[model samples]
Target: MKIVIIGAGAMGSLFGGRLAQAGEEVWLLDVWEEHVAAIRAHGLTLVDTAAETSIRLNATTQADAVGQADLVIIFVKAYATQAAARTAAGLLGPATTVLTLQNGLGNAETLAKVLGAERVAVGTTAMGATLLGPGRIKCGGHGPTHIGSFSGGATPRLHDIATIFTRAGIPTVVDNNANALVWGKLIINVGINAITALTGIPNGQVMANAETRELVRLAVAEAEAVARASGISLPAADYFDQVAAVAQATRDNRSSMLQDVTHRRRTEIDAINGAIVAAGQRLGIPTPVNETLTLLVKTLEKTYLV
Candidate 1:
């Protein structure tokens, strides 16, 4: 498959490297010039727990350079989805599939605005990554990845993509309700990301304190309420338990938001928690905890490395 990965950061590089190693024709397009240059010069370095490997693939800072692709996997921040789509439009063939492993809600809608819903797919991944340097990322927790059509159904194309991921060693599944899948991932991000970024703690450390755990719960509850209010059914019945389980499973990992803060890079706060706050406002669902967390993360972003 001719694949182009937008926003080749940690997760992007992780997937791109794996697919490239699996002998797929993969190109990584990102604004990270240094990373792109490093990958172009030395290949992408994927550091597993006890093993290290590199995959040579095409990479460029300009999306137009990639020509056309059979699939476009979006791994960018939610805030950059539309811009990435716009930049990537030149790379989309008539039958190209666009899927997002991005966190947060409304990514499908944003992508649909650019490429139309017929070409868009929504997805979430449990796979985690830590960027050590340009062209280098440590593969953290490996988890299931789910992809589905934006219209809440699966097509043969969706199953084909899932099979590709599974063959590359990343377990994947085709789901029906894309919104529910996005929200299921969003619920976990909403509860964990902002708090960890604020407190400078890992996922396990964040859940170790009772007060913080409740705070996570409250934030997730508000998000859950907003999801139900929007008439979206989430993946889990005891959603808070699912959040706690994620915290446990990926305990040692710092979330993407926390990684952004530590690196003094801009975060997807507006996309994750802030997206929840916007939905709550539109739906009249009170979300003080999420609102406060959003503000706190944004404030920290302003003050970081100043």
Candidate 2:
């Protein structure tokens, strides 16, 4: 199957490089001219805990290069989702599947509005990847990827994709309730990512600090209420345990939010915490903690941008 991966940063390059190395026809599309040029010249590099390898694949900066594909995996930032979807419209066929493995909520919904709901799938990846340089990614953590249809429909293609990842040594699972899984990840991110970003600390530090741990619990509790009000079943009591588990797994790793903050780039705070606040408003639930976090991040973003 022909596959196209939008945004060749970290996660996108890791997955695209693996698929290409596995002898699949994969194309990496990005707007970054320098990165695309580097990939086109020297191939994409994948640096993981196991080994560092490079795979030659078609990389382009033009969206028109995103021709018809059986699957299109979008890895753009949350704020750039619409633009990426619109550019990737050329890659859509009648049976094409568009899957988004983005963080937080509403990404699937946004893609569904651009592409049809029947053609859209949502997923969350626990795979940790950091951009080492142009056309290079350092993969750190190991975890399973979960994917499924967001419209509550069963698709055999999801299983096919999961099998492909499994063959490439990336564990994957297909679930009927991907939205719930996404919400679960959102709960964890709400608790962990922002705290790390604000404190400039790793997961271990946040979990080890008594005051920060309580603050994380408060944030997760608020996010849990928002999720429950929106008809999502997320038990708050077990949610903290899940957060602690992530802390243990990636103890020394900085979260994507913290990385973004350090790089002076915008964080996914809108799609993460801001999503909870929006959902709370729609469901008549209060999300003061999430609101406060979102506002603070936005304020910080403005300061850095200026």
Candidate 3:
């Protein structure tokens, strides 16, 4: 099946490269001109802990270059989701499946508004990646990716896509509760990512510091309350363990928020912490910790933007 991956950054490149290497028809689309040029001239480069590898794949800057595809994976930053979805409109066909594996909440809803719920799938991935250079990415951690229709139904095409990814060594699962899984992932991100950004530490360091660990727990608890109020059942106890496991697995790797801070780019603070706060407001739940963290990150953003 034809697949187009929007956002071609670390996670996008990692998945696109592997899928292309596995002989699937994959196109990597991004707005970064230089990265696209470099990939077009040479090939996408992947540097993992194991070894450095390269794969020849079609890469382009214009979204229209992707044409039509059987599947479209949106991997952009959460803030960029709406724009990406609009740009990807040119690539959607009658039977195309649009899947969003972005961080935080509300992405599927956004896509559903633009692309229709019947064609929308939402998911989460534990896969970790870092952009090393223009066309270079470091794949550092491995984890399962789950995809499912937002309306909680089965899609045979999704299963076919999962099988293709599985063949590329990325474990894939199809679940009916993908929205709950997304919330679970949001809980993990709200707890770990912002703390890492504020402290300029890796995930493990945040877990190692007693003060930070307590702060994370408080943030997670607040988010859990918000989730429950929204009628979402998160893997609460399992989510805590998953957070710890991710911290241990990516001990030396800085989080995406930390990377955003270092590069002076905008963090997904709104989508992460801000999402919790918004949900709380709607449900009359107090999310003080998440609100506090959201303000802190916005404060940091002002410093960088100024």
TM-score (all chains, Cα) for each model: 0.96, 0.94, 0.96
List, residue by residue over 72-165, the lDDT tens digit for candidate 1: 9998888888898897688888899998889887788988998988999998888888898999998877779988999778899899999999
Best-performing candidate as measured by lDDT: 1
Residue range with the least summed lDDT across 10 consecutive positions in model 2: 228-237
**lDDT of candidate 2 over 1-306, digit per residue (tens):** 798999787888888888898888999989889889989999888886678788899999886756798999999999999997897678988899999998878888889998988889998877777787788887756777888897975578889999998887678989888778889899989988888888899876878989999988889888888887788865335788888988777776778898899889988998898888998898888889889888888888898887
Task: Please list the Cα RMSD from the true structure of every candidate, rounded to 1 decimal place.
Answer: 1.4, 1.8, 1.3
Q: Which regions of candidate 3 deviate over 4 angstroms? A: 236-238
Computed on alpha carbons, the lDDT of every model, listed in order, comes to 0.88, 0.85, 0.87
Error of 3 at 22 (Å): 1.1
Candidate 2 clashes between residue pairs 3 or more apart in a chain or in different chains: none
RMSD of 3: 1.3
